[model samples]
Target chain A: MLNIENIDVNYGAIRALVQVSLEVNEGEIVALIGANGAGKSTTLRSISGLVKPQSGKIIFEGKEIHNFPPHKVVEIGISQVPEGRRVFPLMTVLENLELGAFSRKDRAGIKEDINNIFLRFPRLEERKQQPAGTLSGGEQQMLAIGRALMSRPKLLLMDEPSMGLAPMLVQEIFNIVKEINQTGTTILLVEQNARMALSIANRAYVLETGSLAMSGSAKELAENEEVQKAYLGH
Target chain B: MLSNFFVQLMNGIALGSTYALIALGYTMVYGIILLINFAHGEIFMSGAFVGLILVTVFHVHIIIAFLGAMLFCMIMGVIIEKIAYKPLRRSTRLAALISAIGVSIFLSNLANLIFGANPTSYPPTKEILFPVKSFELFAGAQVTNLQILIIATSAILMIILQYFIKNTRIGKAMRATSQDYDTAALMGINVNKIISYTFAIGSSLAAAGGVLVGIYFGVVKYNMGTLVGLKAFTAAVLGGIGSIPGAMFGGIALGIGEMFAVAIGLSSYRDAIAFGILIIVLLVKPTGLFGTEIQKKV
Candidate 1:
């Protein structure tokens, strides 16, 4: 339920995104796959209002949101789990989750949701009072996802959640992402891990440099010769 | 002689509590935004004037006047942040620092123009809080009821502030903002509002310190904040610039150290002694006692 149309973004002299366009329909896990500097994160950042585009519009559920700030974007049911997890380093795990629902006013629902999250991430529950920075890589990734879920966003834009994790933890995170989609939350996942991302995504787009290079069903893209050569390393 | 020494210690505590009150403002603002808020001392100075106007001009009760001064300074602090500091937030740290110094100069001059450069003495304490009374300890050492009032009130306010920072939802938001500004905004925390709230709380504490100092020392001057503000800043840095507990400890330590210096026949070097202690402490621990070493990610 989100449409980004021909948005151009720049960082002074460097062009980060050049007329980039993409879309995510409701209940679909849309994966944006690219290499190190292929503008995947930039696209997500523009949608989240962290980076304002120079042209074109970002339509979320039919309203243009290109002018909104990061907080306003969250208020409208779009939450972003930023690159590097970015959890409050000094705060307890529970407090991090509490801040995730900062825009909500339902006290009882917040308490219940926190409990639900604790059940889902039992390791976090065990260290509920511990500072988030002390969490291991895998656990911090879980905390980041859990924190995003706390906001109850209809659309969760996650950037590089699988980065810096062990291979086993990466598999676990991919499984959790699929499970989250099964529960009906639309996801816009930006990742360099194309193989795992394509395996779980309903639809996928390949970004080369700053523009969309290919788009198709996950299965078709996974089998495409050029995609296999460039992204999947087959 | 020993009892007289204890008497000086008590007086030092009374004075130190006032410094601690002002230092809290410094530490909290620095913790969140990393700006020194040099104008804060002027906020404290304005607090005394606010108390003076309420007491002398409006004839309000001392308790009400104290609260009034705090409320007035809280608003002033927020306004100063909105006007002076907020615009410079996105600029370099140097720009914000320069803006702070400018605000400090502007505020002090404004106060000087309004109240004149002369020092104004507070009304007699006997007419304000109950009749002034004294208690005698061993060796003819004495403590006034007003001294007890200042010390007890400061303690209670500090406890309340500690509770606020530790337990409240807004406080949690503040902690989050201080840790990561963008992440807090992504979580839908209005970071600007949190910053304003910080200024309000810090300014109010400084105002409370100002009123206490006005009553304790029996005089308020346009530039009273200069030395006291510097010492409070030294205290904040000495205790660990951004740590709440560190600010409290730093203020009290600096106050007691100054008094003890005076006691040991070093009264001529009183101000120099405060900075000297700060320099030595900082040299030993560059981050101050509570400041965490900045962790660099490769």
Candidate 2:
């Protein structure tokens, strides 16, 4: 489980996140939905230690990890599938996956996990020797997710997994996310696609500008009138 | 005339091998951090001096001296990165570049203070290693044992380097870091360590080059790095700044070109010819021969 308490993030003169707080319980998919510049990504970035919060603390399983560097954060079992699917363009698919487990030392375990990932995403196996950048957008997104899973993180933070995908591909990616959570890994997903996100999430938080606007069960948030109008495009 | 050409070709290769060695340092560092590392030439100079001391003062074996110089420069390179470039990682590219030049100036001047302005020559190869004998290739195209040694040493180092980058885990991590620094961290790679590793590898190669040059040319001067460093920089740019194979090819090509300039009775314009080729390459193909189109993030 993870707890973020009153975290504030700023980009020089601009306040990106102000007194924002959220929580994710074990074995659940938590969705944080917002429009552009709504601080959803900033929230995920803060938790991942890519950006530091000026105030408050982030506790991961009872340890304060607010000041940890990004690599240290990953070492403590938190992995991020960053936005834009920043896979290493020149590296082969297998190499990218190998680097994902950079902090791990179990050779046998790594080999087995890589095989399991290949089984889950057969397209990746077919292109294991090909450079990652040559993959299609949907394939690259799958590779990104696969790369993150390589780290074997207990807490996976996904930022816009469905951005820039075809609608059908988006559905496939969401299905994969649901399948991943069903296997018992806690997921904190940030999305612009609120309808799809809420459909899969057990609990949801709505972000407006740089503050948390609302929080409730996924069903309640989806059916709420103002939430439907602002986020769901109803 | 044909035999004369062949002899010049061999000489060019021996010289180009050194350039190629130094150029690898430039290309690798630039690939990872996007810094030109102007102090690299000074690192080469330091390597030559270190090798000189080991051979003359400490009385070490030639092979031991070569390896020692590399080890010394590897540590030196990492320290330079920590002191000169690491703190400027978040600053502008210009700031890092200026810091590099500052490091370069500091290093060269330090060498000048220590070694003085006079050029020092290596002991005769016959006394230290082996007799310098010219072996005939054909009619009159001859190659010295020293030329063969230099070229073979450079080739072996390059082969080992290529294998290291291609097959090793740390090497793969290095490639990943070069491609995406932050994303690499997200995968649990300590990028700072990777950068240090890069500096270490690059500086070692430059050191190897320095020792080989000191042995081949029989002279090591305090300020030798200035012009040679600039020439190696030219080679890196000519071969495509960030491409590994490109640096090798560019260095050799520049070396041959310089020799050919001398062969064609334009000896005085040799340096001019090197820079002229760089300008032409930039105008014709700014990315150099093997460079991919650099993506600019918005």
Candidate 3:
């Protein structure tokens, strides 16, 4: 459904990604796993148009989007839940979700989607009037996902959704990710939590430094000795 | 003496309403894009002259002139944002600020060339609207029709603005944009469009204030915005740089404070007092009363 080919990205003097290529087919949850500064977040950022690639192409369902601005990228049905759950700190939860659908004009459908989000995350329904900044880390993560889902995206890019949650909350979040995938939204997930990511992801790629080091079926990569030693800490 | 005090207090309210109106333009633009928009004061000055032109040359009613000035400045604000602020969005904050100051100087000079640097009085209010009259609120406490008109119109405009920001979808997008620019774009909001809209709304309010100032003070000048603009900006900072309510409160407080100073025969130091309040506010609460502290994400 999405293809990134030989993309290079830089931040001034620092090369953030070098020759990074990856793909996600329809109805798949693809995980990009790596350590800090391993180009995982940069790859997702490049696809979402937050960071433009110096070279290579990003084709989403066939059309190139590497050069599109971030707002236009979302208009083409791509939504990103950025790292650290950057929800609008001063906006109420409902306002945050309403902004999620800023590019869309279907008021009734937008309202319906918001209700569905509330149903999925009942705590959000209870705290709809509260400022998002007041939410706990776990709840803020939920709000971030729920906000992205408000756009009715064809492809969702989730960056480190499990970064700072309790173990049980992390499990709950992974379960929710699987549930979202089952509902027909293709996902490109970047994570440092390899075990939980591999458990849910259909396929996985391991990135080292600024380059892709390995790719395979999720099970095989999980069982691979090198991935196990380096990522899984076994 | 006490009646004189009451009359002066009423005058302060009318004057402060104008300050609050202009201060909102500063605060809103600052909240969204973090630009001080030094040119904003020029926008106010331009509004007064535009109203004057419409009233004198076109022979329009005072109300029509007021609305015309607002519409003119609304477009002016958008044009200014696109030309001056948009190109510098990705550049350093200082670059945009310098560009803003440049625009301010250019606008004021342009106005001077057109209006000839002379202070022009508005048409007599009794001739245009109603008889120049005053209501006796109490012993020596009187409010003129003009003062009442200015205060009421400003209050109505402010309420409408408040409603628009609180209840509308675009308003929600605005708040989101102000909170986090990147995250707002990620939600598919055209951040540029929101910025332009913000400029339009704020400029309209400032223009309205400009017209009211002309009516209340009976005089308008090319460089009028220089001092009023600074006062409005001070009001914004005093209230908390980005807080809407803070701007409102700060303007009134400053207005009343200035009136009290004048009452105590310290009128010459009124400007100094305003800046003194700003310094003290910054020293005590640098964020302004309502300014939110930006959180650094890990």
Candidate 4:
């Protein structure tokens, strides 16, 4: 479980996020949907400790992790797949996955997890030795997800996994997210793709210009008026 | 005579090994941080001085003195990282490079003040490395035990270094970070810690190279590493600025090239030979022999 309460974040003097509160229970897929410029990604970054909140707290499990460094946040069981599919381009596809489990200790488990990811993304398995930059966008997204899965995170934070994917690939990526959630790992997904996000989310929050606009069960939020016009294309 | 040729070849190996070691420092640091640690040579020189002072003042065992040089250089390397590098991590490569030059001048002048402008040598010794049997390769042409040791030690260190980079945990982290920094941090790798370790290892290797140069050349003096470090950086650039194996190849090639210049009766141009090769390589293949070719997104 995770709790982010009344967190404020800024970029130097410019404020980025106002007091925003959100929570995700264990075994849940919580989607934060918004248009461009929403503070969704910033919120995820704040939890991951990349953005030091101006004055707010992010509690992962039971510990206060606001002051933790970016690396320490991952060590504490939250893995982030950043937007833009920024895979380590020079590294081999396999090397990228190996870095995912960097702080892990169980050697056998690491190997097993890699095999599982390869099974999920067979295309990656086929091009294991190739440089990641050579991968197609969809394959790179798969690799990004596979790399995060290698971290064995208890809670996965994804920022725009479907950002640049084809329509069919978008559904495939979301299905994979659902599959990952079914395995009992909690996920906090942030996306501009609201219809698909709320389509699969257990609970959803609408982030609008650095503020949490609304929160409800996925079905109810899908029928909400603003959510319909702004995000769902209804 | 054939003897002269064999002697020159042995000397080449000795010089090549030292260059290879120093070049490793340059390439490793450059690979991880994309900044050329120009003061690397000063670090090597400082190692030699530290070892010399320790041996002369305390009468420490030669082995311990060499290792002490390594330890001292390693710590100094970490200190350099803290002061010279970490602050400029997010800055432009040009700034970091200028900072490295600043560090270079600072250390060199500091040593000049403390040790004086006069060149210092090792404490008077009855024996340097044990003089062993000289093997006659040709009539009156011979390889002494010291040259053999220098060549052998350098080759061994290069081999060990190759193994360390290719197959180690921290090595992987270094490689990962070198390839992608933000992603490495996402995996919980302390990127700065890995970089500090790189400098420490590189400086340690340079320390060993310093001691070997001291013994092989039958002298240890301040400012020795200046020429050697410059040549080593040339080697790094020649082989590929950010490639480890490239450094070794570059170092050895420069060494042999320098010796070849001397052998060809152009000893005055010995320094020029290394620089010449670097220029040619950069012009022809900007990414040295072992360097990874990167394509920038248009």
Highest-scoring model, DockQ:
2
Off by over 4 Å in 4: A6-8, A12-20, A35-39, A89-94, A122-136, A207-215, A224-229, B1-9, B91-95, B123-126, B132-144, B277-285, B293-298
Q: Quality of candidate 1's docking, in CAPRI categories? A: high
lDDT (tens digit, per residue) of candidate 2 on B218-238: 999888998899999989999
Residue-wise lDDT of candidate 2 within A1-234, one digit each (tens)?
Answer: 899999999998999999998999999999999899999989988998888999999999999999998999999999999998998999999998998999899999999989999999999999999999999999999999999999899999999999999999999999999999988789999999999999999999999999999999999999999999998898
Where in model 2 is the C-alpha error above 4 Å?
Answer: B296-298
In model 3, what is the error at residue B129, expressed in angstroms? 2.0
Per-model lDDT = 0.90, 0.94, 0.91, 0.86
Q: Write the residue-wise lDDT of candidate 3 on B79-194 in tens digits.
A: 99999989998899999999999999999999999989789989988877888788887776788988888889988998998899999988888888888888888999888899
RMSD of 2: 1.2
Top model by TM-score, which number? 2
Interface DockQ per candidate: 0.83, 0.89, 0.88, 0.67
| Candidate 3 Cα misplacement greater than 4 A, ranges | B296-298
The weakest ten consecutive residues by lDDT in model 3 chain A span A42-51
Better of 2 and 4 by lDDT: 2
DockQ of 1: 0.83
lDDT of 2 at B285: 91
Error of 2 at B19 (Å): 0.8
- Candidate 2 CAPRI assessment class: high
Query: What shift in Å separates residue A74 of candidate 4 from its native position after superposition?
Result: 1.5
